[model samples]
Target chain A: MPHRTEDIEIGLLLEALYQRYHYDFRHYARASIKRRLLQARSHFNMSSVTALQERVLHDPEMLPRLLGFLTVQVSEMFRDPSYFRALREQVLPHLRTYPSLKVWIAGCSAGEELYSMAILFREEGLLDRTLFYATDINPEALKAAEAGIYPMDRLRKFTENHQKSGGKSSLSDYYTADYGRAVFDKSLRNNVVFSDHSLVTDAVFAEMQLISCRNVMIYFDRGLQDRAVGLFKDSLTRHGFLGVGSKESLRFSRHASAFSEFVPEEKIYRKREP
Target chain B: MSAPPDRAVVIGASAGGVQALLALLPSLPADFPWPVLVVLHVPADRSNVLAGLFEAKCSLEVKEAEDKETVRPGVVYFAPSDYHLLIEENGDLALSSDEAINYSRPSIDVLFESAADAYGERLVGIILTGANNDGAAGLAAVAAAGGVALVQDPAAAYARTMPQAARQACNAALVLSLERIADYLKGLKAE
Candidate 1:
């Protein structure tokens, strides 16, 4: 069968992105990425992916706009309550034994998961001892995550999720809602270090007690996914926890043997000692 | 009869979807040549049991679609509740947690549009009983890609709005009852 011209254009565009900007999305899961690129093409009012590629290659301003589309940022605080609940009831007990803890929130899009973890830790009396490394490839997202503001309307769902995750404190204690925006408490992120990092192109930077890299790797192809899992295995301390998305699994990954399922239903794994 | 031998089928439904799927999917023979992908709107907060529910009834293999898994013939893949399922050009499955479209995360439009891009003319898109218009644009995309578009007849559908909107979106789509749609699929031959 003949290859689609659009697919060819997408390949060229991804290649241009990597060679020009060093943002490697060339190994992302193709279908969703293609859909996102098409959305970007339409958003830019470009006639085709080829035209979009040419424009982005020449104009530096267009790269960030395209990056916004390429990066998946849709997230909710305590998005999957059950996963948080599992972390609270099962994982935290093991983590509490350590005097100091480093938790890595990989792909911390807009700070939802990071904030959720902070609140969970605070409630569990682990806040002062824990340091969070919130990282993402998108600088814009990292900045927003650091700012820690969200629409006020979303708080209801967040509150419900908080309660479901066995929240001990009122969700209202964390943020001040005003004029359709909720500004989260600054102290919640006092120990957080937000930085620009890409699981696709970056290496492990810290030895973490818990690494929550949820939903981010769903966009990766198998090879990239394996690379990411391997990175997680390397970053995690022996018997430390690694939590993936509820739907994502390390079962088929080459690095699967490095971690054993800790809470299999919640997709939480424990790094095995070498 | 004019359908391509190496075709794939995508079906979208909501509201009365479970019953419609049970009635339709079990009719496929064990040796059915093409893979069947289905999306049904369900609550996002809970685990999806749709695959298990259908596995006992359907003759073909039934499982939830996993990210990056190769799409195989003779299997029925259901989109997980909280994620949108898409088909890659190489026929692998991809899942997305992007913002919901038409108030649904596992949006039928997402799946159908991606499948149309993947399979093009060798794809069959079906819209069944649903109260919402989520699949209208998707079925139109399928038709635009030269794929066969099938809509459950509004009069026969448990909920008529979805089929009505889909029919309006694609004038060329065949409007058949659930039974007739199954018969047409059963008539399809392997490549």
Candidate 2:
């Protein structure tokens, strides 16, 4: 299969990038890597992939731009209303048994998901006893996640999503509107520590009862996916739950037999009690 | 940044959706090349039978979207049946309390626009069966931004108004039958 030679050039460029910056995307799936390279081309307006790669490898500052292009960030608050619902109904009860809890929202891009989980924990009578670590590789997203400010107009929709996702009270109760922005309640962060971490190239930090990685694994190849799943498997406590995106599964995965279906329909799995 | 196109797929649904999705999703197999994001607008409440149903039907791993999560391929991420889903610049997920557009917070527009901004021409937006016209304008935005715009033939959609609105708003690439739409996506992976 002859891939566009431009793809070959981009592959070399990524290798060059790793050599210089030490960021390893060599394990990321080729399609996504190819896609990100294409996005970088347009951002720089080069004639072809080779030109784009040439310029990026030569210019040091351009690496950040390339990195941004590579990480096509997408996220939301309390995204799948039901996964949290399941946590609330099924998992939270057991979590409540602990005197305190350590939860990790791995690959938390801009922090909306962490905030959502925090809100859930707060409402579930666990916020005071909870400690959350929202980690991501993108520094820009980490800063925004730490700031916790979002477009004000989005609050109404989020409120609706919140209500529909089994939110116990008015969504308005979570944040205050100022001008055109919704500044989330500062209290939500009291227990949350937003930092920089990469599922691709970093080591796991803590054991957690719930690790909600959502859609972060799609960019990875089968090997990297298994590595991250292995990290999640290692990070989770006994019978802890691992939640992934709707289209992702443990089936046919290297880690497939490691977990059991808890809410298989929802993509929620419990680490097999080994 | 001079590379050929990299296509990504986005899907939106609402109202009588569980069944609609069950019918539509089983059509998408696992190992579909591009990443697909599903926004199903279920009223904010306890959601059930969604992730599970799709999990069983679709070969891809089907689960709800999470905040700040990056998009992944061969995976079908449904909007958490309540909240609106969006894309972040860093390629992570963005969940919001942002007010609803078209009367729904997890409005199809929110997902479509965010995805449009992120993926641009590489993005493929699909407005599936839904009661409201939430995804219509957003689908147009995707088309206008150089993304591929596809809608289930309104006549074939479980909810026709939304697809009709999409066709009216944009120069859609394909107005496909529900089952045919699946075939079209399969072709994308092959490409």
Candidate 3:
């Protein structure tokens, strides 16, 4: 079958993005990326993806805007509350034995999961000893995450999720509402480090006690998924916990044997002592 | 006229979806040649039991779709409750936590549009009984991509707004009742 003209245009666009900007999305899943690029094309009022690519390549300002479309930022605090609950009830006890803890929130878009983890650690009496690393490839998302503010409307659900995750304190204690926004307390991020990192291209930067990289891998193809999981395996300390999205699993990964299913239902795995 | 050799069939239903699916799906023979993907509006908070419910009654294997799983024939893949299910160009299934479209997560449009892109003219898209206009644009996309679009006859639907909206969106879509739609599907040959 002949390639659709739109698909050919998308390939050229992705190539242009790699050649002009250092951002690499070539290994990302094709169908969703194609949809996103088409959405971007429509938003820019361009006739096709090639036109969008031409504009992006010529105008440096368009790179960031186009990057926003290429990277998915959809996330919620305490998403799949059961996963957090499992961390609280089952995983925390194991982490508490360590003198100090380093937790990595890989692909931490808008810092929702990072904030969730910080709050969870604080409630569990582990925050003071914990240093959180929040990383993402999108600079806009990293900035938003560093600000730790969210729309006021989203707080109710966050609060409910926190409670459902067996949060030990009031969710209100962490954020102040102002001008239709919830400004999370700056103190919550006292030990947090926000950085620009890409699982697609960058190497692991730290040996972490817990790494929560949820829903980020679904965008990657099988080979990229293996690379990311291998990085997770290498970055984790022996017996460290790694949590992924509820629907994602290590069952198909080549690195699956390096970790044991710590909480099978929640998709939490523990690195084997090597 | 006989239907083209379809590589896959995608069905979208809501409002009275379960009953409609039960009536339509169980009629599929165990050796049905193409895969069937379904998107039925379900609440995000509750755990999905739709796959299990259908598996007990259907002849083909039925299960919730997983990320990166390869699409297989002779199976019915139901979109999970809170994630959008998409078909990759390589025919692997992908799940996205992207914001809901048309007020739905496992949105009918998301599935149909993606599948239309993946399979092109070798796809069959069907819109069953529903209350909202979610699947209308998706069926239009299918028709635009040269895939067959079939809408339940509004008069025969449990809720007419959905089918009526779909028919309006894709004027070329065949308007058929539940039994006729099933018969049409049964008549389809493997690619």
Best of the candidates, DockQ: 1
lDDT of 2 by residue, A115-162 (tens): 888888888889998899999877777888899999987776677668
The CAPRI-style docking tier of model 2 reads incorrect
DockQ of each: 0.77, 0.07, 0.75
Sorting all predicted structures by lDDT, with the top scorer first, yields 1, 3, 2
Off by over 4 Å in 3: B1-6
C-alpha lDDT score of every prediction, in listed order:
0.93, 0.76, 0.91
The local distance difference test score of model 1 is 0.93
* Residue B65, candidate 3: alpha-carbon lDDT: 96
Between prediction 1 and prediction 2, the one with superior DockQ is 1
Model 3, range A81-170, lDDT digits (tens) per residue? Answer: 899999999999999999999999999989999999999999999999999999999999999999999999999899999999998899
lDDT (Cα, tens digit) per residue for candidate 2, span B16-125: 56666676677776677777788887766544457777787678888777654566767777776545677643465555443356788677887787677667777889
